[model samples]
Target: MPEPATEEGNRILSLWQGSWLAALIVGVLVWGLLIWAIVAYRRKEGDGMPEQTRYNVPLEILYTVAPLLMILALFYFTQRDQTILTKVDDSSSHSVNVVGWRWSWAFNYEEEGVYDVGTPGEPPVLWLPVDEKVTFELTSPDVIHSFWIPAFLMKMDVVPGRNNKFAVTPNTEGVFMGKCAELCGVDHSRMLFDVKVVTRAEFDAHIADLKERGQIGKLDSGRSEVAGVS
Candidate 1:
């Protein structure tokens, strides 16, 4: 897995690692029991017929209960982490409206009143302030698209009429690649973008630059024309 860049991503990584460890432990125990049972119950040369037992109620209950207990444990942890990751509070300092279209992405920096869109030839670059929470509103104008940044360890579906939102605080400052995880259309492979996590000063400067270039107003299918190949 790619290195997580946000605190939330780190937590997600920890959960994934924990799940793998649990699975490995269960696998070892099961395999060990199977091997032992095969070797110990093997028929000897003089043995006429092994003890034919109809059923072992105790063993049956043990197997059933053990699996249920393991599932409940995993569910508890998964639910706890999922709640934390999907929680959306009003404490975010910045907000970006992410519009995923047919084969490109458009990022509307609502706080700055400017937007940047990408085309098939040129993918857009999304900027985020390091260590500051930014809430993203994901939507798609046409078919279903998925907004995925591997470094963030998160992905959300961008459905056509529904809006999905999530927030993340980028702790690291660097460039990361993002792409549409879903198969949208013919040019799905070209649906890619870049994420740049920078300092507050640099982030502000970028917004200012966008405003200076007259890229003002939110760019979405509902408000403005999306600048990209269909």
Candidate 2:
């Protein structure tokens, strides 16, 4: 697993670790019981037919209730973390419109009114402000594509005629890689992008640079003639 670069990613990592630990504990108990039963209940040469018990109510109930309890515990934690990861509110400092096309991606900085479009040869860079919550709105103009950032430990499906969204606060400042996790078309392997987390001032500077490059309008798939796409 990649090192988590966001708060949400860290929480997900914690959940993953906890789940593995629980599984390991359960595995050990099961194996230990199996081995113990095999060694303790082995047929003795001198023993005739052992006393047959029709049913052990306590053991039957223990087996049934134990598994159900374990399942419920796992479900509770999983649901809790899932809710936190997918929760979206109005507290985001910025919102980015992520448009996934046939073979690349386009990013619209809605708050800054600038966009960055990528081609198959040149993947675009998504500039994010570190320590700030940013909501990503995902859409696909062509076939389905999945917007994924491994470092962030988050991914969302980008479906045509439908909108998907999620929020994350990048806590670390560095460059991370992103890509379309779904196989779309001929150049699906080339549908990639970069995520750069920088300070607020640096993020603003990047946005200004985009504005200076004449990429001032939103390049959403809904609009005609997406600028800066070549």
Candidate 3:
């Protein structure tokens, strides 16, 4: 059966293909040359064995140099792809703080001045502008947990004492589901949230609407209600 491919799996596949093809070529050439050398140098069953020239420095060098160059080329491209794909360009990117509580995710858009404090019915949904970079500063309020959004192809561990930083840019605009990939405790299964990627205008509208609805912050009337009671 053919193996399935994923976006990340594809990147890995390409990296392996480079080294495998080079090795395959060398293997076939080495085998063919060995056959030819064995046939040409072999002595008849009854004939005395010819004296052997044990080692050729040039031949040994050729074998060593070929594989070494292939390996170096493989490492070079692998690292290049890693840096290009994962490096964060913060200057042009927006920043969000993703905090993992006991069993919830709160995606705070620090740049937008909105922080959805993760209520029960309304969890913090990360709204990102498609094709734009966004930096995530991840931390956990208690215990260890993991933050993963598979569709965007990034994940990192959230430690209580440390803040993890990474970046991603969604290529397609859509709602991608993410969950606490770690087993934090009994309620870990319910730690779910969605990442919404929209256009810049739509994102602005969403924050405005969320703010108005008292989802991101206390709505104007709700605030006035509290003031009236106090």
**Which candidate has the top score in TM-score?**
1
Per-residue lDDT tens digits for candidate 3, residues 1-230, read 11211234346456667768878988999899999999997877888867779899998999899889887887898898777656666554688888887657776777666665453345557788877777888877578889887775566888888977877656677887778888899888777788888988998898897678665532112122223732
Ranking by TM-score: 1, 2, 3
Q: Supply the TM-score for candidate 1.
A: 0.95
Q: Which residue pairs in model 3 clash with each other? A: none
Off by over 4 Å in 1: 222-230
Instruction: Output the worst ten-in-a-row residue range by lDDT, candidate 2.
Output: 221-230
Model 2 C-alpha lDDT per residue in residues 1-230, reported as the tens digit of each score: 78999988988898889999999999999999999999999998998998989999999999999999999999999999999899999999999999998888889889889899888888989999999999999988778999999999999999999989999999999999999999887899998899999999999899889989998877766323564344
How many clashing pairs does model 1 include?
0
TM-score per candidate, in order?
0.95, 0.89, 0.61
Distance from true location, Cα of 197 in model 3, Å? 1.1
In terms of lDDT, which candidate is stronger, 1 or 3? Answer: 1
Worst 10 residues of 1 by lDDT: 221-230
lDDT scores for all predictions?
0.91, 0.90, 0.70
